[model samples]
Target: MAVYTVAQVKINDGERYEKYRERFGAVLQQYDGRLVAADDNPVVQEGQWSYEKIVILEFADLDAFNAFADSESYREIAAHRHAGADSLILVAKGR
Candidate 1:
């Protein structure tokens, strides 16, 4: 089954966050992950949204997603994201 990674981020440093964003696509592509959506100003139809940005990623499967997320290379790159923003990241099994 396909899986999705949803991330809601509040950026502390735009320059640093841009660095993370720029490098992310290359890493994601290696794992067959695709960027589904990314928005800085999301339209909230109902409840409040506290985050400044939202990013959605789609992967071939749970295992693929896990492999990408758990890889040492990704972990090293993710440090930039961690340092640049406060984020809530979740994984969901797609229907």
Candidate 2:
């Protein structure tokens, strides 16, 4: 099954975030992950939204997602995200 990663982030450090953005695509490519959607201002049709940005990623399966997300290379890069933003990340199985 395909898996999707949905991340909602509020940036606190532009420099760090930019660093993360720079390296993210290369890391994703290493694991066959695809950038599905990334928006700084997403339109919310209903309910309430609080995050400053939203990023969605797709992977071949749960294992693929984990392999990419949990890899050491990604972990090294993710340090910027940890320092730069407050975020909510979720994984969902695509229908």
Which one wins on TM-score?
2
lDDT tens string, model 1, 26-64?
999999999999999989889988898899999989999
By TM-score, how accurate is candidate 1?
A: 0.95
What is the C-alpha local distance difference test score of each model? 0.92, 0.96
What clash count goes with each model?
0, 0
- Runs in model 1 deviating more than 4 A are none
For residue 82, model 2's alpha carbon misses the true position, in angstroms, by 0.6
Best by lDDT, which number?
A: 2
- CA lDDT of 37 in candidate 2? 99
What is candidate 1's local distance difference test score? 0.92
Off by over 4 Å in 2: none
lDDT of 2 at 72: 99
